[model samples]
Target: MCGIIGVFGNDNAGRLAAVGLFAEQHRGQESCGMAVSDGLLIRLHKKMGLVKEVFHEEQLNALPGKIAIGHVRYPTKGSATEFNTQPHLVETLSGPCYALASNGDIVNYAQVRKMLENEKVYFKSDNDAELLVKYIAYRILHYKENIGDAIRNLMRDIKGAYSSVLCTPTELYMFRDPYSIRPMIWGKTPEGTVIVASESCALDTLGVQDRKEVPPAGIIKVSDSKIEVLDNDPNLYREGNCEKHCIFEQIYFSRPDSFHFGENVYAVREKIGAALALQDEGLNPDLVVPVPDSSNFIGLGYANQNGIPLSLGLIRNHYIGRTFIKPEQAVRDESVRQKFNVLPNFFNGKRIVLIDDSIVRGTTIRKIVRLIKDAGAAEIHLRIGSPQIKHSCYYGIDTPTTEELIANRRTLEEIREITGVDSLKHLPLTDLKTCVHCPENYCYACFDGNYPVGVPDVYN
Candidate 1:
């Protein structure tokens, strides 16, 4: 998944978008970009780096406008390169210019791209954001449709998870896919500046108030004259009437401070931890040690429920990025070493309960277990906050193949052995459902292979 931000009615739109993008840097780290419009022209600036590196003070100053849209990208649909970076701009000879940034993958990318190609539409990048902007631009130019009409058509035809922001020279529009598989929230500042982002935390950082989710199959347009919110019936485009937000967001992905899908992110994580603890009723450990950062809240719940003292035994290097999101296996392997370290004199002769969000490929957790083992821990009983990820996630996450998943490749006992932990358990699917306010509204396709939106044909 990626992070998207849009700002309107602000003179320093570029700077404001940069601040919001920085708040969402955890969502994506490979690249960041911004498109700013000053009522006459849209200036685009994108680069292959983090938000701070790409959109420095000098870079933001160059993009002077009252409207801006930005993106922080983690490669899912395209390779990691500047060309695939987002806020993709579409300029035409007839003076209409559009820039778009999106936060989820497109399942029908290949088929739709071929259809657009047959219609003689040229493509520069193989990214999904490019396809979205081009498709909308194509409709506006050829079919004589307005921006909202073109986006509604896109929602009906394009099948995947997309929380998107589109900006023109005069207005900014935000929309989401039928399933609402990803989070999209928007609000207005006290000064009347409109803002939209993939997560509420970003909006909070920008001083936005009266925040709300861009509803399922929803479209919102903001301009100088008015703010229009067009809420559509999601059942028309999706299989069921209920929203299918990705459950993994609460387990991992999202920042704990954020809120979405009608629940607080950290509260759901704590509930997941409590559920995990419920399964290990008999076994007790000396201390509960989370793998740092993402698993902290889970460990907290587990500790609170089990009456065990929680310890921050593993310290993580803030400079290192998340190992799981690294593109290459070798890079991920090397990052584990730099990312985490065991506390001195902490694990000696102690039975430790280790907590982690999930074991996707099982590489990072294995190394973490090895580190604690080397520190003379008596036992390492591993607990995962989420259910086993046995299937690939095509809607947003980068788990493109089942073969890459440890749960799919190995049995439970084999995974315990592979990670070198004394015992291991994952939060059951049923238990996970109980942790959420609306269990039916979330998608657990990665755990049970019951895809709400059908997988791509190649995977089928």
Candidate 2:
């Protein structure tokens, strides 16, 4: 997943963009970039690092414009390198246009790239962002009378989840894939300054009023004085037929303070905790302990509603990098220990209820359980905030194949035994809707095997 933001108005465009990106830093930490349009030229600054590390005050002050776009990217499908960083500016025949950023994966990237390559369209890198830019540029070459018509035609050629922000000198535009697998929200300051971001938290940081979500398979265009909704396909509004919004957004991806589709993320997590408590009514643990970071909200909710004490029995090392060590089995085992330290005083001699988001391959959960067990916990109850992940995610998440998912082959009881936990509870797939407050809008394809977008035959 990635985070994107675009702002129109205000001379300190780069600084505003940086502020928005900093608010969205949790979405992506690998790379950060910002591009500013001064009506005459587009000035760009991007690098492979955290927001604070990449954009210094001098750099932000140097890019002068009243309009800007920014991005913070996490490498899911492409190699993590400076070349792949976004806010990619393309000089198309329809004048210079900037494809700021997008937050979802394109499953048909390989096919699309191959088709473009067959026509001798040489590319600078293997990143999907560049491919998307080329596709948009190509379409604009044919349909330049109206930008909306060009984008509509381009959408028909690609298949996958995409929530994007594109900007020109005169306007800022937001596009959501038909399925809305990723989150995108727009808001305006009291002074009428327009802002679009991957999450509402960014707008909150900028003190902007919360606007409605960019509808699925919809486009919103903002100019100096007007905002227009370009509905390329109205059929997507059909109830129960809209594409699924990624479920992971609520579980681990989104900021706890943000809201998506009118549902507050923190509240949804609390609901998940309540569901877990109800599902495993028999496990009367002495304390509810969160795994830290992601699961803290849900753990608190569970403890509050179940009348169990909530304790921070585990502490996470905030400095751990995504690729700190190699992906080798031995290295993976060692990293888990280094990443988390159990508070022996709190966990010892206590029946603990451990809450986590989801178990991908069960390796990390097993290691965490063993760590807690070694700390002298009398009994351990595993509570997952979401349903079992039985299928792979094609829309940007780095999940393994079905054969590798533990839930695909083993039952909950078997998993409990494998992890050495006294009891285990997972939220049911049916309860996911209730947790998110959108029974029909959110996507649970990862748990139910129903993909909103077509899965490609091959992926990188």
Candidate 3:
């Protein structure tokens, strides 16, 4: 739901972080910020806007240091406010100043916040990212725990998905939750710069090839000398760790070219499309058309398997962000037309198989169907790459209320009737499991209502 990156040991750390963040601008657009460490102080510059809007030559120069971390915010868990923007600078009295940038949401927010507050640990923001920074800082500053112990303890105590990067005045630290429900990868450049990001696309932006991922319940440290794990223990993260990485990230959140969790995101989506096509063997349509951008790869696989021509029937605006993940339905509706355009001539009189990632509230799809049908398409056979999302996700994605989820309350026929699609079929559970290959390593709460971790009271 958010994009975070850390650049260490680079002379142009601020600039590099900016480029990495720009690569992941799709991850978040509500707000952004960057923090750089100048050895004595953590110079901070963050605001309620896009990365490009918040940082420029002047802003980057103002915050200069050997270590820099950046964040793009979609705010799945937090409200839209400048106060909740990251990278959050944590000023600890007992230790050196550091900043925190995190992806994913914390499920045990209420308990953790109350515990920290009862200890008189003052907080500046109401967001979950701030809780993580304060928790680690509390351990290091008050308990005199080492950085490794702080991270290790955090993994043991925290109860939700978090793939995060932290930067001190002297070193950069990165870690993932025990479940590894979010994506975080580490790469290094020939120039001796170390980079950690929410996805490998950011590393591609930095031209780094020598890469490795931080394992579930894993931690990485980068200093002037070298980048290494804080603990050399061969058995901790290796022996028995339950790694239920969010499969949705591979299906939608990540860029198609990005490699995450040891698998190419685009490749997995293509396989999902192939599976969907195998299930939809008997149906015949004139051509396959994608909703644009995120679902393009899935449509390619579907079209390739079905022996139907694939066309860019819907031309997506490269300038706008994704509409489904945008916060409000009013904003989504107003932005939907601006985001996509149906090629009237191309789709004229064609029986089109329209492929999209998944349906959330059914608002976007209803509008899309109306657009294509109004443009002269005779029929729209809507094929979703994933199964119906019936449960709200607590681990970063913002579908928290069941009432807002169309599939949770409506039957398949009702959904089809509501969208006015001639026919609609979602990727079956069996087909989805086949494509993912490891159903056990995924939190399928949104599809099957099987929460890997206990749900928060808010969701209940």
Candidate 4:
């Protein structure tokens, strides 16, 4: 739901962090920020906007350091406010020093925050990133534990998905939760500058190759000379108590070029499209069109495998951000207006197969189908690349109620009628598992109600 990156051993660490944040802008759009550490001090800059809008050349130049961490914000946990923007700073009397940015929702946040409050810890914002920073500072400054021991304890205590990168005045540290519900990869540039980001695409933008994921429950410390593996503990993961890697990351959240959880994101999506195509071979469609950005490669795979000609029947406005992540339904519907347009000739008088990632609330897709129909398409066959989402997501995603999910409330036939499509087919749960690299480890809680870490009592 958010993007995080840290740059170490580079003089233009702030600029590199800015560039990395721009590459990861898709992961979050509500806000963006960067924290730079020059070993003596940490300079922080954050605001509410896209990456380019938030930071300018003058601001980036002012934040000079050898190390920096950046974040793009999507409101998975905190309210939409400038006060909640990250990387949340932890300051001593000296200056704003330790900086932390993390990518997942903490399920036990309320309990932890309450405990911290009872212990006289004052909180400035409702953001869980702030809690994480305070918790780490508490462990290091209060309990007198080293960074490695503090992080290990954090893994044991924090009971949810969090892949985090932190910048101390002295060192750069990155770690994943015991479950590894989000993605983190690190690579070193030819100049020996090490980079840790939420996705490989961030590194690719920086011209850094030879990337590798920080394994589940793994801690990585990047220094000038070498990268150290802090904690290799696998007690929870080996026993299968917390082995659920996020399936939605491959299905929707990640960029196609980025690799995560032992699979190429694009290849996995392509395989999913091919599998969906196989489910309806007898059906014929004159043209195959993807629902713009998210389903592009999936449509390519379907068109290539089924020998159906692919065309861009719908043109997406790159100026618009993702609508589904918007806070309200009215806002999302209004966003859909500017986000897509029908190409004149492609949708008229043709049997079109519309490929899309998934149908959540069915509001956006319904509007898109109306556009295609208005463009004079003779028939619309909507093929979704993922299984029906029958439940809601609690870990970092916005949907948290079953009532908000369309597939949970309506039958397939009813849904097809509602969308006004000639035919509708969602990729089956079984096929979806087979399409991924590690089928067994995926968390299909939203599709099948098989909550890996168990849904909170509040949702129930």
Candidate 5:
């Protein structure tokens, strides 16, 4: 997944967009970019670096505008290169003009790209954001459609998850796919600056007073004169008449401080911990230790339910980005070595219950277990917050093939043996649903393979 933000009606739009993107740096660490519109020209700047590194004070000063759109990418659609960095801008003969940034993958990318190519629409990068912006530009140029009509037609043809922000020289627009598979929230700051982001935490960082989700198949337009909300009938685009938000957002992707999908992210994590605790009736470990950061709240619930002391035995280095989202397997393997460490004098001769969000490839957690084991821990019982991820994800996450997934290759007992944990148990799929508010409204395709939107033809 990725993070996207848009700022409208703010004189320092570039600076504000930078701040919002910084808050969402955890969502993507590969690269960051921003496009600013000064009502006359749209200027773009993007590079292969973190938000702070790319959008420094000097860089922000170079871009002056009252409307901005930004993105932090994790590389689902293309390789990690400057060429794939987003806020993809389309320039006409006039100058640099329309720009777009999005979070989520396009399943029908190949088919759509071929269709556009046949119509003589050239492409610069293989990224999904490029496909989206080029598609809209094609509609606007060829069909003589306005921005709203172009986006509506895009919704009818595009089949995947996309929570995107598009900006013209004079206005800003925000829209989500009909499935609403990713998070997109918008609000107005007390100072009257309009803001939209992939997470509420970014809106909170900007001191937004009132906030709401961009409805499923919804489009919101923000111009100097007015702010308009245009919502479409979601049933016309989705298989069912209900929403199918990605369940992993609540389980692991979202920040604990962020709220979306009508539930607090941390609360859902805590409930998953409680559910795991309920399954372990009599097993009492000396300490409940969580793989730092994401699993902290889950460990808290497990500790609270089991009356076991919650210990910060594992300390995570803030400098290292999340290993799971690292673009390459070699990068991910190297990150686990630098990301976490066992607290000194801790885990010695102690039986510990280790809480982790989920075991994807089984490489990171296996190495983590080895770290705790090497620290002289007597026993380590690993508890996962979510159910097994048996299928690949096409909506945003980078689990591309089932062969790469540990669950699809090994049984639970085999996995436990491979990880070297004394015992291991993943939260049951049925138990996981109990943690969310409207369980039916979420997608569990990664667990049960019940894809809300049909898989791409490539998979078939």
Candidate 6:
């Protein structure tokens, strides 16, 4: 997954872009980049690190223009390297064009890259963003029309989920794939600055008002004082045009402050907790303790509905990276302890309800359960916010294979035994639909095996 931001008609565009990207730094941390257009030239600054590490006051000031685009990327579909960092810029025959960033995975990337390679269209990197840029540039070259027309035609050949922003020296463009698998929104500041970002929070941080979501398969163009909406493919809204959006966005990906399909994420997670309480009638815990950070919202939901006190039993060390290299089991165990420290006071002689978003491989859950149990908790009742993730995600998420997914091979009882929890319950797949207000608009392929897009042949 990745986060993208673009602004047009802003004086300190690079600085503004940095502020916006910092708000979305959670979406991606592998690399960060910003490109600003100075009317004639696109001044670019990108590096392999977090947004704060990559852009400083000097770097932001050096890249000066009225139009700027930025990206904070996590390596999901591509390798982690400087060459793969975005905002990818390419000088086409017509003009110097650059695509700031795109979210979601293109299932047809291999086929598209093969076709391009057959024509001797070489690429500097294996990043899908580069391939997407080439495809859009190819369409512009072949059609010989305005940017909107070229983009409209380009969408016809492209498949899979994408919400992206593209900018030229003069104008800024934003588009969402037909499926709308990823989130993108457009907002205009009170000062007449136009902005596009992966989430509304980015716009909120910049105090941009007049916000509206960029509709699926829709294009928004900003040039000087002109703003145009091009709707060449209205069929996207005609029902059954695509599979449901990735449901994981609500479960774990999006920020708690953000809203999805008009429903507050925190509110929905509470509903999931209520549903879990209903489903697991036997387990009544004294307190609800979250796994820290991402699961805090869901834990609150579970606590509120069950009338249980919510406590911060586990304190996460914010210093640890998401993944680490450990040469031995002893090192791995030590890493886990360093990553999270248990607050023994919260769990002492209390029946703890441990809430987490989802259990992927059960390793983390197992470790957490063991820690809480050892901390004098009478019972550890585990509840997951979402249903079991049985299948691997090809869209953009980096999940384990079917064989590695704990849910695929074990029942709730077996999983509880494996994790050494006193009892365990998962949110039912049916209740997952109710968690998000737009049930029809979500893709639960990972939980229910109903892929909205065609499953790739390689996975088969």
| lDDT (0 to 1) per candidate | 0.92, 0.79, 0.86, 0.86, 0.93, 0.79
lDDT for 185 (candidate 1): 93
Off by over 4 Å in 3: 232-240
TM-score against truth, every candidate? 0.99, 0.92, 0.97, 0.97, 0.99, 0.93
lDDT by residue (tens digit), candidate 3, 1-460:
8999999988789999999999999899999989998777899888888788888888888887889998999877778788898888888665698789999898888888899999998887888889998899999888889888988877766678888999899999998887788999988899889999998999998989899888877788888877778653423532244578888998898999999777889989899888878877888899999888889999999999989999988988888877877888898898887877887587788999999999999988898899998899988999999999998888888787888899978999999999999999999877787776576777778998877766874555
Per-residue CA lDDT of candidate 4, range 176-264, in tens? 88778888999889988899999999999998878898888899987766789975675753347546788888878899999888899
User: Model 6, 282: alpha-carbon shift in Å?
Assistant: 4.7
**Model 2 misplacement above 4 A:** 234-240, 321-335, 409-414
Residue 321 miss distance in model 3 (angstroms): 1.7
Q: Which parts of model 6 are misplaced by more than 4 Å? A: 234-243, 321-336
Worst window of 10 by summed lDDT in candidate 4: 234-243
| lDDT winner, 1 or 2 | 1
Q: Given candidate 4, what's the lDDT at residue 271?
A: 89
Model 5 CA deviation exceeding 4 Å by range: 94-96
- Counting clashing residue pairs in each candidate, in order, gives 0, 1, 0, 0, 0, 3
Clashing pairs in 1: none
Worst 10-residue lDDT window for candidate 1 reads 451-460
How many collisions between residues are there in candidate 6? 3
lDDT of 5 by residue, 32-56 (tens): 9999999998999999989988988
Candidate 6 per-residue lDDT, tens place, 207-235, comes to 88788878878899899969999865647
